[model samples]
Target: MTEPLRWFTSSHSNNGGQCVEVADAQDHILVRDSKDPHGPALAFPASAFAAFIDGIKTGELR
Candidate 1:
């Protein structure tokens, strides 16, 4: 059985009303719209998400 997702928002959420919530689901990272929690979600591998975050910190992602 899988555990329930515990979604959280980043501290940089004051940049207007647009934001996303993220949750860790074992092997993947789940992302959902903060405006519509019950809406569709996008999933990415944990490693991939980590890489994306790293790229963001390094200003490598545009």
Candidate 2:
């Protein structure tokens, strides 16, 4: 059986309704808008997601 998603938002989120929730799947990282829990989610490979986060931290994504 596949593992269930355990979604959570950033600890720094201020509940401003513009946040996103993330979950770790077996082989992918899932992301979705906090305001739309039942809506569709986007999936990214784990390595790609890590790279994205790194870019954000380094201001390369801005």
Candidate 3:
């Protein structure tokens, strides 16, 4: 049997109707548009995903 996908969203996501959802499992991280839950999802390495989050927190991605 196939494992079900577990999804998560940013804690900072507001009720303003704009947000992104993420899913982390195994060695990869999955990102997708919250507005289109059944649409495409992008997969990234756990380390790369962590770095991206760190960059966002450090104001290097803004």
Q: Local distance difference test, per candidate?
A: 0.91, 0.93, 0.87
Please list the residue runs of candidate 2 whose C-alpha ends up more than 4 Å from where it truly belongs after superposition: 1-3
For every model shown, what is its TM-score relative to the native structure? 0.85, 0.86, 0.83
- Native-to-model Cα distance after best TM-score fit, residue 37 in candidate 1, in Å: 0.4
lDDT of 1 at 4: 76
| lDDT of candidate 1 over 1-62, digit per residue (tens) | 76778998898778564799999988999999988988999999999999999999999997
How many clashing residue pairs, candidate 2? 0
In candidate 3, which residue pairs get closer than 3 Å at backbone N, Cα or C atoms, i.e. clash?
none
Q: Evaluated with lDDT, which candidate comes out highest?
A: 2
Winning model by TM-score: 2
Better of 1 and 2 by TM-score: 2
TM-score of candidate 1 relative to the true fold: 0.85
lDDT of candidate 3 over 18-48, digit per residue (tens): 6888887789999999889899999999999
Candidate 1 vs candidate 3: which has greater TM-score?
1
- CA shift of 25, model 3, Å: 2.2
